[model samples]
Target: MLLTERLMAGERVFSAWSSVPDSLNAEGLAATPFDAVCLDMQHGAHHEDSVMRCLGPIIASGKPGLVRVPVDRFDMAARALDFGAQAVIAPMVNSVADARAFAQSMKYPPVGKRSWGPHLAMGRSGFSGPQSAWLDEANRKTLAFAMIETREALDAVDEILAVAGIDGVFVGPSDFSIALTDGKAVDPSLESMMEAIAHISARAQAVGKHAGIYVVDPKLVQRYSAMGYRLFALGNEQNYMERGAAALLADAGALTS
Candidate 1:
């Protein structure tokens, strides 16, 4: 099912968003936990080949997956979707036009003019099966998440939300912090940013759309949930892995009495 479908049903989706460029670990991680995986093709070491490699495992894992491409480029968007990603989360979506284009590039034919072909939507071209038809339904099934990452995006969140056909908005706090600080860390400025995000959530709820967010501080997850955040990318794979390993080692050292 498309992410939008699940979100519309009022399911609080938990996704793992990451910048791990290695396909092996990415696929393994996707298969392990998470309702979906948003491969970090943006600001990560992943190239087109890497994206393909990472996605290969995700498809085989029986998990729904999405990718965050570097920019709003249609080719990148089209390819990411072609690779069987249930969705594509675009970065720096700050306007209604950008959101429209993001949605336009994601669909096919009347939905969007994406060059049609069977690459990974099915195992092969001209290969039609009940499951294969599932891929064809992608035009209707695929999702498009426009990231709310900048101050500009916050300002236009309501207008952007008014755009029809957009599945949801993903909040990128790091970049959002940058936008708030003009390039600094998240702090007091975050209060207003949080308010802006909350406002977006309310608007989404009003219009029956979805609102996704990245949760860095685990403490904030439930708080945001109370404010109506539906899709939560709890944290990147690297964040948890690093913290877990470090904590284990620290505990081991402390036991050396």
Candidate 2:
């Protein structure tokens, strides 16, 4: 099922965040149990070429591929879709205008102004049908998630969610915590930060829109789920490797000792 469909069905889904710019690494991530794989271009090392290249493995692995485009890179938003990303998460969308620009880049005409050039998308999805068929389903199938990371964005959450073609909102908790503390520190678990996150989720839920978040601690998954966050980006390639290696070394040490 598409990530959008799963979320719309009220199923909690987790996506493995990919920071490395290698297709092999992406394939490794896709083969895991995560429901989806999101290539991060905001702080990660993924460039346009790497995103295009890595998506091939993600598609072959039969997992939905998503892209977190760089801050304010609306052009990359459309390109990521064209390159076969099922969804594009735009970072730092602080107002209605930012949300509208993101939506314009994500959806086709009438909804937005995204030009028609989903050649790779069609092939990746294996839809060898009429263009109209694909066009008809594109808007619904392709999701656009606006990031709510700043005070301005959190304040305008309702208005941003009201914008057409915006399928959901993603909470960048670390940045949000920093913003909340006036650049003092990054802490996703602050009581005030959690309260704000709950508000964002409640607003999205009231509108029947989806809500996603980056979960730094696995133990907090249930808590975030309770707050109505159906989608989660949990850990990156490095985290996986470190955890796996630590487990293997611990087992070896036990055996030897």
Candidate 3:
């Protein structure tokens, strides 16, 4: 099922964010039980060419692929979609205009201005149906997530969520915490930031739109889930690799006993 379908069906989504920019890693992660594979194009090591390469493996793995496109770059979002990304999570969408632009880039005509050119995406995504059928389904199947990171976005959450064609509001908690405190590193302990997160989730839920968030630990997932966040981007492979290697080393040390 498409990521949008899962979200609409009220299923909790667990996604892995691939900041490593390696196709092999992307493929491996996508093959897991995670609902989606999100390639990071904003802060991660992926450029256009790399993301294109990563898409092939992700598609072959049969998991929905998402790209966290560079901030407000509608063209980049369009490219990601055209390259087989089932969804595009646009970072730092601070206003309704930002949400509209992001939505327009993801949807086709009559809904938005995204041009028809799923060159590699058509085959990569395994769409053997008629072109018209694909077009008809694309808009609804394609998810657009607006990242609410800054203080401005938190204040305008209602308007952003109200924008037509916006699938969800993705909370960048780290940046949100920083924005709340004016240039400090993300400190989740702050009561104000916690309140902002609650308000953001509440606003999205109020409108029947999904609320998503980034989490480094599994324990936090339950906490955010209780607050109505259904979509989660767990930590990337780099962190996983480190943790895995540490566990293996500890096991080796204990094996001598």
Candidate 4:
């Protein structure tokens, strides 16, 4: 099923966050148990060429490919879709206008101004029948998620969610923490931040939209799950490798000792 369909069906989807721009790294993550895979371009090393190259392996792995485009990079969002990404997450969407611009780059005319060019998307989605059929399903199949990381964004969450072609909202908890604390700290698990996080989730749910979050710690998954966040972008490729190596070394040391 498409990522949008799964979220709409109320399923909790965990996606692996890929920071490395290598297609091999993306392929490795896509082959894992993650329901989806996202290429991080905002803070990661993913450039336009890499995003285009990396998404192919992800799609070939039979998992949905997603992209977290850099802040205000609406054009990359559309390009990612054309490159076969099922969804695009726009970071730092702080107002209704930001949401509208991001949405405009994601969907076609009437809904938005996204030009027709699903070069890789058509084959990846197995739509070899007709162009009209693809066009008809494109808007619903592709998802656009606006990141709510600032006070301005949190305040305008309702209005952003109401915007057409905006399928959902994603919380950048790390940045949100800084914004919440007025640049004093970068703690995502602050007790004070819980209310705001819960409020975001509640608001999205109230309007029948999907809610997502970037989870730094895996243990907090269940806590956020209870707060109504169905989509989660977990740690990146480096974190996974470091954690796996640590666990393996620890087991070997214990056995040798």
Candidates in order have lDDT scores of: 0.76, 0.94, 0.86, 0.92
Per-residue C-alpha lDDT of model 4 across residues 182-243, encoded as one tens digit per residue: 99999977779999999999999998888999999899999999999999999988899998
Candidate 1 — which residues are off by over 4 angstroms?
124-127, 130-136, 182-184, 187-189, 250-257
Steric clash count of candidate 3: 0
Tens digits of per-residue lDDT, candidate 2, 67-174, equal: 999999999999999999999999999999999999999999899999999999889888899999999999999999999999999999999999999999999989
Model 2 stretches with alpha carbons more than 4 Å out: 254-257
For model 4, the superposed segments whose C-alpha errors exceed 4 Å read 254-257
Q: Please give each candidate's TM-score.
A: 0.86, 0.97, 0.94, 0.97
Q: Residue 206 of model 3: what lDDT?
A: 91
Scored by lDDT, model 4 comes in at 0.92
| True lDDT of residue 170, candidate 2 | 97
Residue 93 of model 4, lDDT score: 98
Candidate 2 has a TM-score of 0.97
Provide the global lDDT of candidate 1 against the true structure.
Answer: 0.76
The sequence of per-residue lDDT tens digits that candidate 3 reaches over residues 141-233 is: 888999999989988989998888898899888788889879967764455677778888989989998899998667778878888999999
lDDT of 2 at 234: 94
Superposed Cα deviation of residue 184, candidate 1 (Å): 5.1
